[model samples]
Target chain A: MVPLSWYLVVAFMLVGLGAYGMIVKKNLIRILIGAEIMGNGVNLALVAFAVYGGAFSFTAQGLIILVISVAAAHTALALVLMLMYNRRYGTVDLSIVQKEEVA
Target chain B: MNWKVKMMQDLQPVLDLFEQFEFFLIAALVLALAYLALEHKDIVYAVFFFGFMASAVAGFFLLLDAPYIAGMQIAVYTGGISALIIFGVLLLPRAQDSSLETFATGRVRTMGLILSGVIMAISGGLALIFPWPETIPEGVPEQSQSLQGLAEWLWQDHGVYIQIIALIILTTLVGAVALLKMEKAEAMSSITGEFGVEAKPSPEPEAETEVVDTEETSEEAAN
Candidate 1:
C-alpha cells in the first residue's frame, strides 16, 4: 500500500518551490504561477488527509477544492489580463509609468 | 527455493520496480514542469508549462485516491486559468520578447533557493521519520455518497458563507467592468485629443488595429 506520507512530502516540496518562485520571480505572471503552485500544494494536502484520516469524505474535499480552484482561476485571469494591458502600453516594469501626454 | 518461494520473490521484484518507477517518475515530471514555468521568459510559454505542471500534480492527486480534486484540478487550472493566461499573453505587445535580462537575480534569488532547499529538507526528513496514525477511530464513516452529502452540507451548514462569497465575486466582476470601461473611455478620449481632430467613431476592429499599428510603430522607432 502507498503510504500517505509520500503524498505529504510531495505537497511540501511543491509548496517550498512555490515560495521560492514567488520570492525570486520578478514578473507578475510568474508570481501568479507560483501562487497557483502553492494552491495546488494545499489541495494535495487536503485530499491526502481526506483519504487517510477517515473524518471526511473524498467528495466533500473535492467539491471544496473545486470551488477554490475556480475562484483562483477567475482571479488569476483578471490579474493576468490587466498585466497584459499594462504591457501593451509599453510598460510592464512596475517601477516606472510614463504618463501619456494629454494634448 | 521452492515454487511458492520463487513466486513470492518474483512478485516482490515487480512491486519494487513499480514503486520505484511510478512515484519518482511522476514527482520528477511535476518538479521539472514547475521549474520550466518559473524559468521561462515568455509569459505564454510559462503559462502553458504551468498548466502541464498542474495536470501532472492532478495525476498524482488521482493516484492518492482523490479523483474529484484531480478532475477539478484539470478543469479549473488547465481549462480555465491556462486559457485566460494565454489570452493575456496574446494581448501583450512584446509577446515574443525572450530577454533573460528582464528576470531578477543576485542575492534575492540565491536566498530564495537556499531557503526553499532548507524547507524541503526539513519537511522531507520529518515526513520520513514521523509515524502516521494508521487506524481510523471507531464510529467514523469510511465510505460516503459524496455529492448528495455535499449538497446537504452546503445548504445546511455553509449556505450563508457560500452566499457571501458569491456576492463578493459578483461585486468584483462589476467592479472590474466599471474599471476597465472607464480606462477604455479615457484612452479613447486621449487618442482623439492627440490626433487634434473630431475622431470618427471607429469600429471595434479598426480601433484594435490602430492600437496594434501604434505599438508596432513605437517598437520600430525604439529599435
Candidate 2:
C-alpha cells in the first residue's frame, strides 16, 4: 500500500497550484476554477486522512457526498455572480473595479 | 533451489514498488493538469484543463480504494460543474480584444507565487515530517469498508451536516435562477447613472461594439 505522506504531499501541491490560479488570474471564471481546484485538493487530503483512520473511511465517503453537492452549489452560485458582474460593467475584466473613473 | 527462492523474495519488493509507482504517476498527472489549468491563457481551455484535473483527482480517490467517491467525483465535477462553467462562458459577452486581459500584473503574480508556495511548503512539509503509520491499524471495525456502514454513520451521526448542506444547495439553486432571470437593463440600472451616455449603444458606428454585445439576450428579455 502507498504511504500516507505521499498523498498529503500531492494534495498540498494541488492546493498551492490552485492558490496560484486564484491569485494571478484576472477572469472571474478562472478564479472560480481555481477555487474548485483548491477544494479538490482539500478533499483529497480529507479522504486520505479518513482512509488512514479505517473506521472513519465510511464517514468520509458519506462526507464527500455532502462536499460534492455543496461544491456544485458553490460553483453555480459563483457563476451567477460572475454573470451579474459582467452585465453590470459590460465586461468581466475585473480590473475595472480598480479604476477611479467608475464608482 | 537457493537462486529460485532468492528470485521470489526479490519479486515481492518489486511488486510493492510497482504499486507505489502507479500511484506516483496519478499524483504527477493531477499536478500536471492542475498546472496547465492555471497557466492556460484562454478561459475555455483553462476550464477544460481544470475538468481533466478533477478527473485526475477522481482517479486518485480510486487509488486510495474509495471507488464510490471516485465515481461521484466524475459525476459531479466532470459532468455537472464543468457543464456549468461552459454555460457561463457561453453566457458571457464576447470581448473585442481578448488576447491580453486574462492575467494579473507581473508583480502581483510574483507575490501570489511566493505566498502560495510558502503555504504549500508548510503544509506538505508538515505532512511529510509527521510520523504516520505505514498501514491501517489492525482491529478496525469491519463495518467501515461497506456502503451500509457509510450510510449508517452519515445518517445516524452526521445528519445535521447533511441537512445544512442540502439547505445551502436549495438556496443556491433559487439564487442562481433569480440572478439569471434578472434582466441586463435591471442588473446595470444602479450603475446606469454613472455610465448613462455610455450605456446605450448607437448603431451608427463600430464604436463601443464591445459593450453592445449580442442582440439575443435583449430580445429574449423582451419576451
Candidate 3:
C-alpha cells in the first residue's frame, strides 16, 4: 500500500486550497464551493485511513456514504440560502457583509 | 481497470511506488480541478469545474478499492449537488452573477495563501507525528468488503446515524421550502406597495429632510 502519509499530504493540500478559496473569494457560492472542496479533502482522508487500516471498501461504504449524504443535504440547504440571499439583496457578493460590518 | 493487485508489488522506497503513482495522479487531477473551480470568474463554470474535481475524487476512491463509495460520490456530487447549484443559478434573475467579482486582489490572495500554507504545515505535522498502527487492530470489528457487507453494517451497527441523517435531510427540505415561500411573500408585499417593508428604502437623509420640512412649515405658520 502507498504509505498513509502520502495520502494525507494530498488530502491536506486539497484542504489548504479550499481554505484559500474560502478566505479570498468574494462570492457566497464560491465560498460554498470551497466548503465542498474541504469536504472532499476530508472524505479523501477518511477513505485513506480506512483502507490503510485494512477496512478497505467496508468503512468506505458505511462512514463515507454517511458523510456524502450529509454533504448532499447541506448543499441543498446552502443553495437555498444563497438563492434567498440573492433574491433579497439582489446579489450574492459577500463583500456587503464587510461594509455592513455584521457580526 | 482492476490494477489493484499490481499495487502489492513493493518498490525501493518506503512507500508503494506504483500505488502512489496512481493515487497521486488522481490527486493531482482533483487538485487542479479544484483550483480551476475556485479561480474561474464565472460562477456557473466554477460549479462545472467543481463537478469534475468531485469525479476526480471518485477516481481516488476507486484507487483505494472502494468502488461502491466511489460510485456514490459520483452520484451524489456530480449528479445531485452540481445539478442543484446549476438549477439554483438558473432560478435567479438575469445578470445577477454579472455583478460578482470572484477573486480578491493580490494582498488578500497572499494572505489567504499564507494562512492556507500554515494550515497545511500544521495538519501535515500532525499526520506525521501521530503513531499510526501498522495494521488493523484486533479490537475493531471486521467490516467486510462489498455492498452487502455495507448494508448490514449500516443497518445493524449504525442505524441511528442513518435515521439522524434522514431527519436532517427532511428538516432541510422543509426549511428550504419555507424560506422560498418567505421570499415570495416578501415579493408580494413589495409589489403591493406595503409600507415599512425592508425591500424599498432610501438613505436616512431622506427621512431627516422630511422632518426638517414639517418643522419649517410649522415655524412659518407661527411667524
Candidate 2 local Cα displacement, residue B45, angstroms = 1.2
- DockQ of all candidate complexes: 0.37, 0.59, 0.47
Candidate order, TM-score descending: 2, 3, 1
lDDT of 3 at B220: 100
RMSD of every candidate to native, in Å, equals 9.4, 8.0, 11.7
Query: Against the unseen true structure, what C-alpha lDDT does each candidate score?
Result: 0.70, 0.80, 0.80
Candidate 3 similarity to native, TM-score: 0.77
Tens-digit lDDT track of model 3 for B13-94: 5345656788768877888899999887777888899999999999988877777888999999999998987787666533
DockQ of 3: 0.47
Q: Please tell me which predicted candidate would have the highest DockQ against the true structure.
A: 2
Model 3 C-alpha lDDT per residue in residues A1-103, reported as the tens digit of each score? 5667877888998899999989998888789889999999999999888877744645456777888998999899898888778666666777776778875
Higher-ranked by lDDT: 1 or 3: 3
Kindly list the interface RMSD, in angstroms, of each predicted candidate in the order they appear: 3.6, 2.7, 3.1
| Residue range B108-202, candidate 2, lDDT tens digits | 98999999999999998988897766455755433454566666777887788778887998899789887778666785554454235354455
TM-score of 2: 0.78
Candidate topping lDDT: 2
Candidate 1 lDDT over residue span A1-103, tens digit each: 4677888898888888888888887666677778888777777777766767766663557466546645653665467456545635554543233234432
